[model samples]
Target: MLVFFIAHFVLHWGWLVLNTKKCFRRNKEIKADEIIEAKHTAID
Candidate 1:
């Protein structure tokens, strides 16, 4: 459960961190592909 929470929220947090600047400048436009790509990078 703890690991699940960390994995879920870590990906969410990473996505948020990656898009924070754009979110602040424009709007909450989350590019999920980028998040997925990041996950792939980590997995690799």
Candidate 2:
């Protein structure tokens, strides 16, 4: 029972970390695209 609990906790923690990293990277990409669009608009 203890081992099962430990395994569940570890899996949950890893999932949360991975999800956060994915979100952060996606946000960064979106921001970069917005910046690029703004630059193009300024040039035009």
Candidate 3:
């Protein structure tokens, strides 16, 4: 029973880390798009 609980906790934490990484990557792409758009607007 103790082993099962430990395995479950480890798996849960690993999943959280993976999710946070994906979220951070998505935010970076969005920020990049915003910068590109601003540059285009400034030139026009």
Candidate 4:
């Protein structure tokens, strides 16, 4: 059970990192902070 949990956590973290990188790459002109804010706004 612990191993499964750890695996899930690692995958989730990796996905988040990759997703963030993709977002950054999508807009080279925008700053990181702006991209983050735009993401949050789109989510909300």
In TM-score terms, which candidate is top? 3
Task: Name model 3 segments beyond 4 Å from true.
Answer: none
lDDT of 4 by residue, 1-44 (tens): 99999999999999999999998787775677798999999999
Q: How far out, in Å, is residue 17 in model 2?
A: 0.6
Q: List the residue pairs that clash in candidate 4.
A: none
User: If scored against the real structure, what TM-score would every candidate get?
Assistant: 0.44, 0.87, 0.90, 0.60
lDDT of 2 by residue, 1-44 (tens): 99999999999999999999999999999999999999999999
lDDT of 3 at 4: 100
In candidate 1, position 5 carries an lDDT of 98
The whole-model lDDT of each prediction reads 0.80, 1.00, 1.00, 0.90
Q: Write the per-residue lDDT of candidate 3 for residues 1-44, one digit (tens) a residue.
A: 99999999999999999999999999999999999999999999
What local lDDT score does residue 6 receive in model 1, on the 0 to 100 scale?
95
For candidate 1, report its TM-score.
Answer: 0.44
- Count of steric clashes across candidates, in order: 0, 0, 0, 0
Model 4 / residue 15 / CA error / Å: 0.6
